[model samples]
Target chain A: MVGVRVDGTTRLMGIIGDPISQARTPQAINPIFAGKGADIVCVPLHVPADDLATVWAGLKAMPNLIGFGVTLPHKQIVPQLCDSLDPLAARIGAVNVVRREPDGRFRGYQFDGQGFVRGLIAQGVVLQGRDALMIGAGGAAVAIAFALQQAGIARLVVANRTFDKAEALARAVNEATGTSFATAGAPTPESGQLVVNATSLGLNDSDPLPLDVSMLQAGMTVAEVIAKPEITALLRAAEQRGAAIHSGIHMITGQVSLIADHMIAALG
Target chain B: MVGVRVDGTTRLMGIIGDPISQARTPQAINPIFAGKGADIVCVPLHVPADDLATVWAGLKAMPNLIGFGVTLPHKQIVPQLCDSLDPLAARIGAVNVVRREPDGRFRGYQFDGQGFVRGLIAQGVVLQGRDALMIGAGGAAVAIAFALQQAGIARLVVANRTFDKAEALARAVNEATGTSFATAGAPTPESGQLVVNATSLGLNDSDPLPLDVSMLQAGMTVAEVIAKPEITALLRAAEQRGAAIHSGIHMITGQVSLIADHMIAALG
Candidate 1:
């Protein structure tokens, strides 16, 4: 079987999350490491919420540790642990990746939003002049909102179960992008050319779709952030409505190459 | 091209040492993990002396981390960090391995000495009725002395640059084994049927032999603990004298299987 060859000198990177067993970065990224002939292996570290700070401190002090991928409860909290943050990650108040600089400083970056945008672009969806309706204002949603704005989306509507959070996310995205392109409102498929499900709503089989499928129109593109069920209810509904659909797996697979690049550059 | 396959769920084991790039445990033990179908990988961790406590504490907190191998400067210090130690390791005041228990407690064990005895036995050398003359009273020497006593060696003579340390090691061995089987003395090939160079004397090409080569006899067995050169100057001299000789590689190769067994058992 083609796989990573770990030895004494192999560089180490890890993904930190409470429930780390299901993390897919190892399989996704290790093959890339093997293909590139990079002597690095990414492992999953189960760091509980309470032990996050301690574990993060420990990992940073390791001389051979190159970087880390942050997820779930860690993404939002890890930005505080970094020595510096990418402007996007700083504005979003979350970090999905931490790379150790050549001078040993740990710098954080958020890849979720960028990954989502890349996935959409890879699927031939044009974001430059399109409007987007984003559901959920949580960590993933915040990242996707900023990334969409950065990708030159003409306008964005942030909708959430809590209107205040959506408003706050919209404000943050607009302030960071220096544009009045984002507004908080209820999701309407007819109002935007792109629809995104950025919440945990589609994780369960019986969970309701994040947005109304009846509003979906042909030529519109829909995407979901939940990867376990690649075709979430929201995506399935959009697909049935004759809209171009992008599954959650694309978001993860899209980031693998970019993350690998960041990690290799950081190794220097 | 055969190597360990690492994934997110692979249990992590590390070897802690200052200069860890040359450590061979990753190559030796990882193959064992793969062969046994154990989802485990041993990696080399370059943990400096100052960062040992912080790094070790962090590693222990990782829920999936099973155990570690302590080498060089960390060996003696690591035993103090363990919740409990194997009886032999406790007596020798050093630990070479630490295994996490099912209840999450970390216990340490010293495999160096045991590995040496096993290597000799594997080579068909009889230890039960043999007398040994060991050079050096450092960490490796102390372990070998204790293991030789435990292996039913008839007697032991420890020689070192500093006589007090050798005396102390001999005393510890006798006290721990409840027998007057070991003594501190000058290096003499005539004193014991088996002569061991446990010191770092043969590490350089220009260094003198640990003992007088002319003193070696045809029926004697000579062993060295240095593995890098495989056949050290002492072993070469022993070979020239037509005495039975054991290389330092035996010490490492013999321990690989035993260490693999301990690590797998600790996964429980």
Candidate 2:
């Protein structure tokens, strides 16, 4: 490339996705990025699922390329290719983070759970000695639920439209950590301590919310993992009812740092 | 990857090379990158010759990928893939550029000759009515000679260890552009106009410079394409004898802006 001035001294990182522009990797990491004295900057790269292998290989061979964030389709695929996979990543059955170490090895880690825990802690949302209702058993749901347990949230109910996935996730977490979990339907603030929505139902203006929050108790806290519409239908509804709401911005912000740290840790 | 701040508005460009970093795409671009009001960043990617077809097809499919710079093996391949090629690009036997049109189509062009020409012009070194001697008949040699002719250089003697390639470059430029080209075996100040070392000589510290300037002419200018040393031995020797000397830096600077313009034009 003519005017593009890359060299061995230039650091490289990227987010690989079919549609790369929608990602928030830039803004969320900006604060810590400025503080870290990092000579690197991450950029977005579009790699369709079908061409993922070839593009991934092409990226790895780049003399200036250090590592990349595996997005969407590549996330699941990366775990199998990595030199090592963090236990939590293997347990969650997905990899939303990947990096190339200084020794030139690619490592995969999942930071969704860790980011959720850190974000919650930052907001002073107490998890210890509390009961949590995790709505939706998909990627983010399982991650949040597992991280809550790690943070000492003693009681958790994993719920989903398809109860099997929720039950499976609960079983996987419970078996892995010996922390007993219960399966429940959509939660009520009366008994559920921390009310979280991991479903895609409230993403758009037209979609219905996961559950009616009018009945939610006044003290019940709410969180949604839908980052695009920072305040999802459920979050907005909870806000109207005067409940504490944690927008997905926290989780998104927490991920880049957590992942960067993991990548650095992996290198050592 | 860290501190990368790509958002929906980021203007995108890419550098295409197998071992990409050796070429300085990012450094050259960053210096002139500010004040554009656009998030213009060029990312480096390695695409090998064998996988270029499919990988390039995938790259074209990216909606945000505005333009790309080609290097090494890809320099010649763009002509075959492009719908049309700039006549100069075809004559030079390679393309170092592929720009996106506003209509989303890409066109191919070559800038090596123009870069060398601009390098000469920028230094205020006159070429009009000057005779020249260029060593090596490779791509860079041909490009520099063509540029020398375009700058109104009157006579040229191309000397290469294997003179056939030099002869071919000379014949092609002459037939294609109607430029006068002449060849000679030995370097003599009486016949020297400008002496350039275009071969892959003078790379390492121990490597002998291809051209000896013991009989250097004061009126002649000396130049070379090898960038690593910044001061090639031939250029140093020529400078000591009062001949004007230009390094690869000016050539690189001259070429970078054209590549950026091509990329922006490609984006349409």
Candidate 3:
């Protein structure tokens, strides 16, 4: 899309989140739009949590706004605001991507969990019949937990600062999937074969690790959901203790093409 | 703004109109943004007349949207929708530009008339004490009429398809300027020394001239507000009749810097 200009015919896509200044969606996805030579651009929308309803109404009225990416605090909340949702998004109880139909109806979709799973699988980490331990019961945690189960994980343990939240999330996933493997528990050395940090604890330097580093074993594999630093304290500590480590950037990289394709497919 | 990217921190400005495909504001003012190295980009938003209110609400809620340019049918309607209006905008009863304040309030401003006057003056077409004949009584006509009066024009005859509309616009301008120089009239051979087309008639190829071209004579200066075609039918006819013809692009060129400066000043 060399020489492409932001003219009237250009369609718009935006990523909505609070504290949006640190987002990499535009940098990661806009180039893909250019690569396809499509007259579409992605922008960042800094929307506060309280004003989400107002902003959502406004976005629905924009005929040229194809859709937007959901992140952080918006992912779980936007599900109720959407007109409809795919089964995966509905089951996960979270949406990371949305598409606006021609009739102005917003349809929600979940790609975060699938992207993370694909990223790990692409690196040759098998999830089939493997036991996994995940931190946090938030939006990302819910989506990833469901995806890990769908990927044929044998046993899963959910950990969170609030034990009730972890318990509720585990119960929902089990009920939705008709499985009895998931349960709320604390992080321990023998928790599972796969240790995942689906929390924001690694986003800032002052933040503590999502789980105790001493619990990581030499044969374990650790993964993260925070991408900015590329190397979180947990990942660093896991590496120092000889556990296999995966950076958070791979999750975004794995789904960048899928998101771009889904957004522009209808335009054609 | 060399190598500028549409990242999270980049602020946005847009031109909103129904037929926004023809708008040149993005092409004209985006370079000005780059020249100043401001991380602000202008995009064209194809918002229909019915969706203006919804889009306005959306833009106000967006913390990073600096403002937008108003055009065509939106100019007149947006005045009432603004949170506040400048004296000039209130006087003209229209707004061609808007700035969103830090507190999410939209401030409307008018520059069409001043820009036209400045463009003519820059070209040495003196309007002081001269009589002018303007076509149409819409948003642009009203703005230019008041600007012509403010430029010390001795008389201004406003001609529109609806005589009542012309009369109303003339009455408003005259009362606002505290002068009885502007009045509703028809275009004749000896209407005024300055003949201007302030309507959308010259936009398409098959459209008739706003005024009778046979009335154009030698020594008369014909100007336009339609900038897409540098040489409109009126200007071409005026040129053939040995009259000085002014291109519509000058109107936008005259005020481009003023608009860009006003939009970005508050940001600094």
TM-score of each model's chain B: 0.94, 0.89, 0.85
Fraction of true contacts reproduced, model 1? Answer: 0.64
Q: B116-149 in candidate 3: lDDT tens per residue? A: 8888888889799888888888878888898888
Candidates 1 and 3, the one with greater DockQ: 1
* Residue B39 accuracy (lDDT) in model 1: 92
Q: Could you give candidate 3's per-residue lDDT for residues A31-57 as a string of tens digits?
A: 888889877878888888888888888
TM-score of each: 0.92, 0.81, 0.82
lDDT of 1 by residue, B1-268 (tens): 3567766677889888878888888888787778899998888887888888888788888888888888877987888889998898888888889989888999999899989988888998878888889999998898899889888889899999999999998888888778999999989877348999999999999998889899897889999899979888888888998899998888887787788888888666
Model 1 chain A: ten consecutive residues of lowest lDDT: A186-195
lDDT tens readout by residue for model 1, A1-268 = 3567877788888988878877888889988888888999888888888888778778877889899898777877898889999998888788889999999999999898889888878877889989888889998898888888889899988989999999998898777767998999988866447888899998999998787789997888888898878888888888887898889888898888789988997765
The 10-residue segment with the lowest total lDDT in model 2 chain A: A1-10
Model 3: residues >4 Å from true position, as ranges?
Answer: A1-4, A121-138, A150-175, A178-194, A204-221, A240-244, B1-4, B19-23, B46-48, B121-133, B151-172, B179-194, B207-220
Candidate 3 lDDT at A141 equals: 89
Best by TM-score: 1
Of the candidates shown, which would achieve the greatest lDDT relative to the real structure? Answer: 1
Judging by lDDT, tell me the better candidate of 2 and 3: 3
DockQ by candidate, in order: 0.60, 0.27, 0.37
Q: What's chain A's TM-score in each predicted model?
A: 0.93, 0.89, 0.84
Best by DockQ: 1
